[model samples]
Target: MTTSTHEKRPNILLITVDQMRYDCLSLLGHPVIETPNLDELARTGVRFDHAYSATPTCVPARAAIFTGQKQTSHGRVGYQDRVPWNYDKTLPGELAKSGYHTQCVGKMHVYPARSLLGFHNVILHDGYLHHNRNKHSVPMQEHFNEVDDYLPWLRAQVPGADLLDLGLDCNASTVARPWALPEHLHPTNWTVSQSIDFLRRRDPSKPFFLWMSFVRPHSPLDPPQAYFDLYKDADFPDPVIGDWAMKEDPQGSGLNPVTSKGLVPKRRLRNAMAAYYALITHIDHQIGRFLQVLEEYGERNNTIIMFTSDHGELMGDHHLFRKTLPYEGSTHIPFIVNDPGDCLGLDKGNVVSEIIELRDIMPSLLEAASTEIPDTVEGNSIWDLARTNGKALERPWREYLHGEHAQGMDSTQWITDGWEKYIWYSQTGEEQFFNLAEDPGELHNLMDSPQAQERIHYWRSVLIQELEGREEGYVQDGRLVVGRKPVNILAHLRSNE
Candidate 1:
């Protein structure tokens, strides 16, 4: 470990994007989407190959990120809005306590619309939240037009223009279209622009923690014209449809625009894919712009940069379109930490295959900043693991991670250790197992295979042990109990002040 000296603390730059998959970058062997900027950033630091979001949705996953706690500790297991965000310890809060100037540029996804949680200032824009848009529960001043800082900025840029002018549904619907407004007017661009403004106005004396978040590549499938044209007619691969998915959705008939498990036709799916990729590329270029500004400030080498996503988008994998599932396409995400200052002695260009989750981000950042990690933060700092590539660790790392989320198909409980995965449905008691090392696409289910029975039983026991003392009584007499009602927010979180 580096000796603690009276050295200047490293500035932290957290760049987060919504609904970006782990395998979408060309550096990760993606055949179509090109993320040259992200690829270069990976080459400069450690890229986690098995990173995940346990509760693979916006709110719950972000809760893990901010609180540095697992789903059980944070109490958000699914996507639910309008719930109070009263966590005592937060990532930015800890950093700010260390004399860091903390500011968040994009999505916080917290309740009360303007809740800052910990950051000193939040130039907020939580893209298209149904709760804030509601006319009844939310007061008029708390509505999107009043609370969202980006709306007024956009209106000023183009008089009387609105984000919904294209008639695209923000969360659901797979419709694709080129952005009607100028490229710089898009939400993705606005996030970066606001971040640049923060850097310019920030107190240079204190180390700043800036969270530059982008809401795109999530939905609305609206890419700027130039980006859209780059992939509109390009060759794209077909979505990975598993045998199990075909059995449940045969003939491509489950065709609701917002259906979680439905078949999107070839042409329509391709259009959506192109638009998604375009948004990714757009964000990548904007990231490049921010890096250039950082260099111009002469702090590129003195800053610690981390790029990741809240969760992965299924992109039609296994007939799944969105997140909150226990599948790789939904839970897996890209995580890269580039400490140009080498503050943590991380092995640059190393691709760590060890299992990790969003909860780990908080402790890791606090550790790098030489700040004390609160007792409430349950996640272990990944500094040592990333430094030694798992050969040595200050503490023994977990063998597997437990993940779950409430869903329309009851709820999904899963366990994984990078190589294999086991999934159990809370209501149906149905089980599925996959050797992720062999079948990365999860094309086959091996739960019933004679040879895999022993392993499946072991994994099932792990789940049972995890849920033993839950308020829902998910386990009875050491056995998993099915038909239990799934809840969005766990009882512990609901009880929090």
Candidate 2:
């Protein structure tokens, strides 16, 4: 086969699904949710089982991805609004610089509401963001409605269609229900529709970088009625309960009784899980259609498709509702890299167990384009390890990745080695450790166990050193301080370094 330059410099398709759990995909071995398209992609690609969202929330996690920096360097350790995402170099910007036509077709929680952030074109749809609608958002501009693209298109479709009509909160992770609108109007379908249209009108001369970011399986938990009915009657396993969860379990989902956390009826919990699973399956189907459109355009065989998520969903685990926790359910995310044989080829069907963070995405994709990764990137390209041609390669990066999310008393910090995970409740200074190899569900808390004493001490010492430069008083005089607020960003820490 004669190699063509187009085959060598393949088009990049980066697909990100919102709030998807690592284990929920059928490819990843979840028993209930059938995500055939995603599973097929995994079968043909390298699946990184240990990939994570370091900060484990929408905004902060994406900052790590788009900038190739950890939460600390990116100055978004946890979720915050209008934090000025003024990165000097961004993933899309860098790709655009390298002659790739970059386009984003879904959720981009970038501040300023309309900031391009380097993408040449962005068909934005960020579900429902409360912060951007605030008066203080996009500071100095001062208008309340930041004007999102989706709602207007939706209103155009239904004349007076309102996504919030059925009282759905996009941030509510513990919620689930059937979509009141037609399936065609669903956000998942709309995103794919826009991507298909972009494909039909895309400039064919350049190798494109497309981000089909799906904002589903996140919330409103609203799947189409047909998708919702697929699992509404199914049985489900009990939520994973840790020994210490009883004290911290939430009573309800925010203020709504219709959806909530804590000890709820098993039937109601199953229904929520069913809807969540159904949303994923729905997205997976749309992905299949998008791939078909790519095939029609003769782009599928030559494109390098990378699928991941911003963070993950807690989905009733430990009586927890959403992300912003250090639990595996919240931080662990799906990462699949489908490098076509004609493209920048990598090992096929490789299940890499090495700990990989979301920060690695920028460098990896740049490497895929045969472009230079900026020296400022904190993560090295995984492509180096992956190009072993069908063999699993365990190249050394960080021995463990540090992650944290701010939630007042529920604020957390943790480090994981894919084998073992150590979590610290930053506020209370309480700790929990799990041998993730044996307990993937995180049901056991080994904090008090004598067997884990040495490991606990080791990780604790690491955290102490890690927090030394924090301005939040999390550490005081070389000791981990209890009851201190876990501040999201230490803006001055960079200058001190």
- The candidate maximizing lDDT is 1
For residues 51-140, write the lDDT of model 2, one tens digit per residue: 899898888988888899987788887777665667888999998998778899988887766778999998888877776555654454
Instruction: Assess the local accuracy of residue 493 in candidate 1 as a C-alpha lDDT between 0 and 100.
Output: 77
**lDDT of model 1 at position 6:** 20
On residues 428-481, what C-alpha lDDT tens digit does candidate 1 reach at each position? 988899999999999999977999999999999999999999888889999999
Which consecutive 10 residues in model 1 have the weakest lDDT in total? 1-10
Off by over 4 Å in 2: 1-7, 134-146, 247-261, 389-395, 492-497
CA lDDT scores, all candidates in order: 0.88, 0.81
lDDT value for model 1: 0.88
Output the number of the TM-score-best candidate: 1
Which pairs of residues collide in candidate 1? none
